[model samples]
Target: MAKLIALNKPFGVICQFSGDNNTLSDYVDIPNIYPAGRLDKDSEGLVILTDDGKLQNLISNPKYNKTKTYVVQVEGEISDDVASSLQKGVQLKDGNTKPARVKIIEEPSWLWVRTPPIRIRKNIPTSWIEISISEGKNRQIRRMTASVGFPTLRLIRTKIDKWHLGDITSGSYVTL
Candidate 1:
């Protein structure tokens, strides 16, 4: 049977096992396990790992169209126009992204505080939004939010397909 692990990746930790900075090895002791999908160093939340190559491919491959959902805190209040623009797909430097499911949401009460926390602008208000996309383009969420003039202040991946961050604490992993 394939071994699966769900991790709540902490901010500032690299996705790989070894590097100059904090990596999965610091949190995960499992041997031969590889992350199925990647969360950037500044991003937090669910990262699924597996020992099976096929399973990893299934989850990470864009062709599979597995939905990845994020709770994003942006620099300013999200306007209806911004939400509509994101839902319609924003043109990025790489190209236009596929349409995404976007909606304003309250900041989740279950969120953990990030170390070296995001900068707060006393004059600027922040708002949260839930964004679900099938394509995992590099820094796609951040770019999408920036394109709409919101600029993400914090980003957390809350779900990937059927798996979720749920109660998994940061820097922790659960065998599934």
Candidate 2:
């Protein structure tokens, strides 16, 4: 089996194992290794690629409860009640989600900016939060924040299980 490689995929890049399509080919240059799970093209973060099917399944499967952490910037100041709701689990369109580890945080000193800046208003305040969830649902963080009133401005994955993005800038990849 090929060795596992951890990649910090930048925004606008697709989570494709192969570069058969023009879109995938244009962004990534890795060969052979396949993505264990996927990050949406617009979401930037840590992604794992490996040839071990069992390891891939363990990380991607919801039943394993492998923790995934994200540093999200939202449009407005997050209320304590909203933070409580996020920790307790908010009702989403799909269903009520699993309770997650959520906390408001200051901007990390090492985080890099996205290629296109998030829309901002001079008068409205914004806040950052770190959220860790066991389930890797589709756009779950976006929906979770929106449900409680503050919509996400930027969402970046900082850690997955024991692996972390750790001081890596956007568009940079480190093999681990």
Top lDDT hit: 1
How large is the C-alpha RMSD of every model relative to the true structure?
0.7, 1.9
lDDT of model number 1: 0.95
Tens-digit lDDT track for model 1 on 82-147?
Answer: 898999999999999999999998989998989988999999999999999999889999999998
Clashes by residue pair, model 1: none
lDDT of the structure predicted as candidate 2:
0.82
Error of 2 at 19 (Å): 6.3
Q: lDDT tens digits, residues 3-99, model 2?
A: 6766777777877845555233454467656777888877888887776888899888989999999999999999777899999999988899999
Considering summed lDDT, which 10 consecutive residues are worst modelled in model 1? 18-27
TM-score of every model?
Answer: 0.98, 0.91
Error of 1 at 56 (Å): 0.2
lDDT of each: 0.95, 0.82
User: How well does candidate 2 score on lDDT at residue 50?
Assistant: 75
